[model samples]
Target: MAVIDLSKLPFPDNDLEKFLDSVCETHELDFAAYAGMNPVTQTVHGFVNYPQEWQTHYVNQNYVNRDPTLLLAKRSIAPVDWQRLRQEPSFDMVFSDAHDFGISDQGLTIPVRGPFGDIGLFSVTRKCSAHDWALLKAKILGDLQQAAVHLHDHVIQSEALSSVLGPPALSAREIEILQWTAAGKSQQDTADILSISHRTIEVHLRSAREKLGALTTAQAIGRAISRGLIYPA
Candidate 1:
């Protein structure tokens, strides 16, 4: 499958809707949705490829506050399967209404942690049997995770959001180190290539992490890429 190049997207609502449609087509999913929280404003922004009525109904009812899928997924580091939430009361409260719209209960939500405490939830659903759902999920799990990050980064960096949350200012050396790390180079390897000591590389990485508000080097690299400081390698 061709990799979805979300960086090329313009981030308009229509474009995001089209992007979700394409994702659904590619993955054979019935629907796809992306919700992102702006940490500074504590406002929720998102788009979905579900039926228009369902979207309106979700908003009218203010289901975002009571939806177990969103609530449970927010607390989880891993993807939250809808199967696990079937027993929850909130699940019934939200999904019971969803059923009226022809939405499926079998789905998965991938949680993406961004710099600046932003969180993105990317969900995809399909109407399929248990065995088929398992096989399909196992096959596309990695791609879904990548899509989640790609969409989240683009959304958070878009013009609509840039004013509230500006990209971090990273130094040239810090960017260089992050670029190398994104390319899968180890600290010692980066040091060797840059003609610096490993300890110096570690310092630069630590500084980069601090600047990017990342808890770890991996997250720093992700944020750097999202901010256009580096490219995927």
Candidate 2:
């Protein structure tokens, strides 16, 4: 495994670009990025070192809705290797276009979750033989996950979530419930895990939604993640 010095990370919370640059240089990666979105509002934000042409192509093509990485990211909490993603045949053009712009199929995406329903995907990509890619991924996967978490946390602390709602204020129980639910646990499943009754769980979730200014439990989860109040388990 590569030796990572966490103390040397960028300080004052605004040097995220420097941090990503350092990682790409140190790891000899082709591209590295940290991207976040507010699921409730579908607002997207990204810190990326990808080729500008690729970015423009993605935007102009309106690929966000069709991007397979995003589709998996929305539902997944675990880190995803690009090779393992299941994409529809129609999305082949997206990958083909990316490759044409020098973006590789060999990549990894780490999903980041926050309290008010803010989700982030930190990704690193490189072009290499399959064997080399696997070896590199195995060696750096842990470090990448750590970096993603740190980057997400820094972004959350530095940025203002919304102009009107501000940061959400959720209770401990509410956060706990939301976290479990974000992990795909049903209300009954969460209630059983927490040793609480189903009705009680529902009550807390309802209150959480109101506190977060969300209209439903799912929206509440999204809002909570956006506020960094509850991370997906």
Candidate 3:
């Protein structure tokens, strides 16, 4: 069976172009982009509607060091409204600089945790009425925010895992169950939280253990965490 295509909204195509177009159309936002920071490389990766020259200018000038969005994004554990960040002292320069690039006063950002300790961001950019942007932001709150970070982070994770760990055999649900198990949840507890049967929970765990080359669920959970297949609950 195919993985449930809950990846993004049921859009017309999987292409990022179509995906972002749908985002703009559906959300009534001006633009969307994913920004990734590689601390190791000291580089910022961004996908946006702006010109390449703009991106290059930011990069060449080493604006990452002073970018308000990047700074706010670094500390945020979840999506943040742009206005919430304008108060931070050093970001004033960034606020002034954003106008040069046409970043709107109103925006939303989804912070993503990438593989190998990288921090990534996905933002909806726009120059619009604050009230309209607020409404749009409210429409996508909780759901779209999680989806954005989840999809973006998972893309990077899948690529990194594909190269370093071959491929994971378990599905997302299986990974979820295994993660809960690692956190000391019982089969019954897992089933309750997952809304599945205890037997089903056991089945998922057993399958995960087999794929992870562990003789027991405990070993499987430990191995999964060590391998970055799971994280702290």
Best prediction by TM-score: 1
- Model 3: which ten-residue window has the lowest total lDDT? 1-10
RMSD of each: 8.2, 12.0, 10.9
Candidate 1 off by > 4 Å: 1-14, 159-233
Which residue segments of model 2 deviate by more than 4 Å?
1-13, 162-233
- Assess candidate 3 and give its lDDT: 0.67
Q: Which of the two, 1 or 3, has more TM-score?
A: 1
Q: For candidate 1, write residues 32-119 as lDDT tens digits.
A: 9988877677777767888889988988888888787787898899999999889999998899899999999999999989877889
Taking the candidates one at a time, how many backbone clashes does each contain?
0, 19, 0
- The stretch of ten residues in a row with the least summed lDDT in candidate 1 is 1-10
How far off is model 2, as Cα RMSD? 12.0
Candidate 3's error at 169, in angstroms?
Answer: 6.5
lDDT of 2 by residue, 23-83 (tens): 8887778889777776655656667778778877877787776777766765788888877
Lowest lDDT block of 10, candidate 2: 1-10
lDDT of 1 at 138: 95
Better TM-score candidate (1, 2): 1
